[model samples]
Target: MEATFEAFVRARGPALLRYAHLLCGDAGRAEDLVQDALVKVYRRWGPDIAAPSAYTRRAITNEYLSWRRRLTNREVPTQLPEPATRSHTDAIAERDAVWRVLAGLPRRQRVVIVLRYYEALPDREIADLLGLAEGSVRSLAARAFATLRAHPELRDAASVDRASRAEPSP
Candidate 1:
């Protein structure tokens, strides 16, 4: 079981970390969070977990929700997960703008955006993973997308494409 767990971590760790990092916006905290969540998954590992990815995502979202519950204020950004890599000032500014729009959202809205857009999870799966009703997921996603779309730059595909290109290689 230990070997099985280790193999699974090796295979899925990168993607898991990516998700956690964006949600928390802090690399160190993201590592800490994923490690903590995985410990729980390991404790409960059994035949019922027919889908490892789904199980792990539930753990991730649950952990993030718990972390958000105790926040003092939303002003202090949980530092970004990615290290500095952009070459130009414009790139860094664009990245910061994107994070500001995302991080400023309420936790539930943020989760909806991250899961639906970033992970490309369908509404049904997102609902199950986040323990939310399907209609609630749809509502939250719609509101969040509306907020994002309200930003003229976000609505422009060319700008988004250019911003994506500016992201430095990790």
Candidate 2:
């Protein structure tokens, strides 16, 4: 079944924000990027965009690129830097750790990881969104995953996951 515009946004909004946050490395900027992309998509909604999710993903990527370009040309920063929020929850800590590692990745690699893992998009779609060959998308994802795997946060997470999956000894 197809999702209505409102339903689509309601269902996918948080995921989109996560993707955007990973791309931009800031929550407020990520919200703005997703909003800008949604406005563009909301304007162009029609039969031509059969897959609204894909359309929105592409819009988000394009908006991020355009915004980054424009930002590079700016002389002064418009907003004051915000401090990172502190939280005591383990889930929150784990998420923050993942975000910290992801923030260190190159833009292309970060986008690839977000789209491939977070959005569950295939290589062909990711390639098309980023205007790269499919092989390039796979290679980028491979490199990104390698980097992620080497990070202590991810390595520890993997170890915990493995331990949880192991059978208890008698």
CA lDDT of each prediction against the hidden true structure: 0.76, 0.72
Kindly list the per-residue Cα lDDT of model 1 for residues 1-170, writing each as its tens digit.
78888898999999998898778777777898899999999998877789988899889888988988976665546334455665766666666666877787788988877777667787788888877898998788667656665765454445545423332221
lDDT of 2 by residue, 127-154 (tens): 8889999889878866766776678766
**Over 4 Å off, model 1:** 73-92, 151-170
Write down the lDDT that model 1 would get. 0.76
Which pairs of residues clash in candidate 1, taking residues 3 or more apart in a chain or in different chains?
Answer: 25-79
Off by over 4 Å in 2: 1-4, 72-97, 149-170
lDDT of 2 at 113: 72
Give lDDT: candidate 2, residue 60: 92
Error (Å) of candidate 2 at residue 124 is 2.3
